[model samples]
Target: MERPTRIGVQLAPQHAPMQATIDAARRLEDMGVDAVFGWDHFFPLSGDPEGVHFESTTQLAAWAVATERVQIGPLVFCNSYRNPDLLADVARTIDHISGGRFVFGIGSGWFERDYIDYGYDFGTVGTRLDALAEALPRIRARWDQLNPPPLGRMPILIGGKGERKTLPLVARHGDIWHSFVGPDELSQKLDVLRGHCEAIGRDVAEIEISNGASVRDGIGGVGFERLDALHAAGTRLLTIPLSGDDGPDGYALDRVPAFLEWRDRKNG
Candidate 1:
């Protein structure tokens, strides 16, 4: 059966107070978004480099308690930030906290400033991907051994577009594969991912395809036309980012109702 289309809003944690970020998550949930996300980074990814930011997992835990229906997670947790075993335990705890509403979205670390500021090794891209590859299995193993297992089978969402190493890792482990590419690039990448899945004897369709939509350029900013194109290209999950800097009332959700309407129309 074809999966229903889903919409998510990423409440970017940069330049916002913790309360504002929490409020944004709650509001997104109220707006009928399928999931709410924050990014794992110590500093801002845009605008002022020295903007206010909160820790990702900690904020996610807060959101887990603040909202009842929405799935919560970091858009992609930096694998290099915490020990893999510890990370699994953290995810498990949050899973229980949210009553099985946590999605474990992770990726190989990027952003040199985060590593240097936090004292983690800012190694080469190859090294980071290797570390992520090694860490994923250990995380799963630790989850298996934890005294109280996760409240449910936690879905693992891997974000990246590297065909050689990343796609293979996704084929082996990911429940969802996320990327920030347009339709043409997404089509090519999906083909590559399918090859990896075939090589591993896994069904490519088992992994949900997720893509990031720019609020300033895609569906939210442009119209439903871009969304229709993405839907036809096999994307099941579409995520739009909301920055904290947008307003004092929290992230601007003016575009969400329309997006939700579009989602319902598409799914129906």
Candidate 2:
């Protein structure tokens, strides 16, 4: 089935206190976002080098309980930090807590600081992708073996733009593929994803397309032209980044409603 257009807010879990993120998640849901995502990282991706930051899994559990309607998960949890089976169980627990509103968004690890500081081996990009390749099946197998499986479908959202390893992985495993590219390049990327799906005998339609958009791009910064084009190209989900330092609250979600309104119109 074709997925409806969705507006997702990626609440950056950095610089602000934990409560700010929690509060933002709650309010973002109230604001009518379809999903709320947090990033998996040990330190701030931007801003202060040693600023306040929270862990993704813990925050996701709290978000699962704090909201009633929206889906929750990391933008892309790094596959390096946790064991595959253990990660499966943790995600299943959160899925139950969310009443089955969780989306498992994952990616091969990339942040060097997160690895170096945490004592994880900072391997080459190729090695990390190989590890992720090895982990996906193990994670799925463990999910099947769990005493209580994930609450619902627990759709897996794989995030990346690399045409080689990443796109192939998405074609084989993702229910939703989150791409970092914008409208101008989306068509070309989708072509690559489709080719991979064809090679694997997977129906390209089964994997929902998700792309990152500047709030302005969707809400009025440039205009909805780009968003319109993306929708035409088959992207059903759009995630806009929220800065912790944008305002008093880490969310900076003022523009969310407008984008959501756009989504409603598109879906309607």
Candidate 3:
């Protein structure tokens, strides 16, 4: 079955007060966004490196309590940061808190600075991917073993563009696949992902495709032309990242209504 077109706002929890981050999530939910996301990192990914930042999972828990609707999760949690079993328990707790509105988005660890500063081993990409591969099944197993399981079958979102290791993992486990590439690149990656699905005897179409909107351009400037291409390329979930510089009012979400109109038109 085809998934409905959905829009998500990633309120990046960097260079902003914790209250602002929480407020932005509420506002995004009010604006009718399907999901709200925060990044998994100790420090800012852009701008001043040592800027104000909130931890992703904790912020997600806060968002669960603060918002009545809108799914919440990290854009992609670093698998290396926590034990898989513990992460599963944390995810389950949040799922219950949200009444089943949580998406578990995870990835192989990147950003060497996060690992180094947080005292984790800054391993090679291969090693990190290996760790992620090991973690997914363990997380699933732990979820089953929990006293109270998640409210529903929790959706797993895997973010990356690796054709070899990552796509295969997505084929086996991912309910949603997120990538930061344009239409042509996404189409190419989709083809590669399909091959991986074929290898595993899984249906590629079962995974929803999610793409990131350019933060530099803002959602309005991305234009319907680009959105059309992305929709054609199999992207049903479009996510825009709001930076801390969007001002103290929180997340300059004026463009969201237009995006919603576009999504409605496309989905229709």
TM-score of each: 0.97, 0.95, 0.96
Steric overlap count per candidate: 0, 1, 0
**Each model's lDDT:** 0.90, 0.89, 0.89
Candidate 2, 98-215: lDDT as tens digits: 9999999999989999999999998998999989999999998988989889886789999888998999999999999998787778889989999999998988999999988786
Off by over 4 Å in 3: 216-222
In terms of TM-score, the best-performing candidate is 1
- Candidate 3 Cα lDDT to native: 0.89
Candidate 3 has its poorest 10 consecutive residues by lDDT at: 214-223
- The CA-based lDDT of model 1 is what? 0.90
Instruction: For candidate 1, report its TM-score.
Output: 0.97
- Model 2, total clashes: 1
lDDT of 1 by residue, 1-268 (tens): 9798999999889888889888778888988999998899999998789989889889999999999999999899999999999999999999999999999999998899999988999999999999999999999999999989998789999999999899999999999999988887888898999999999899999999999876764343576676777789999899988887876665788868877887899888
Model 2 weakest 10-residue run by lDDT: 213-222
The true-versus-predicted C-alpha distance at residue 195 of model 1, in Å, is 1.0
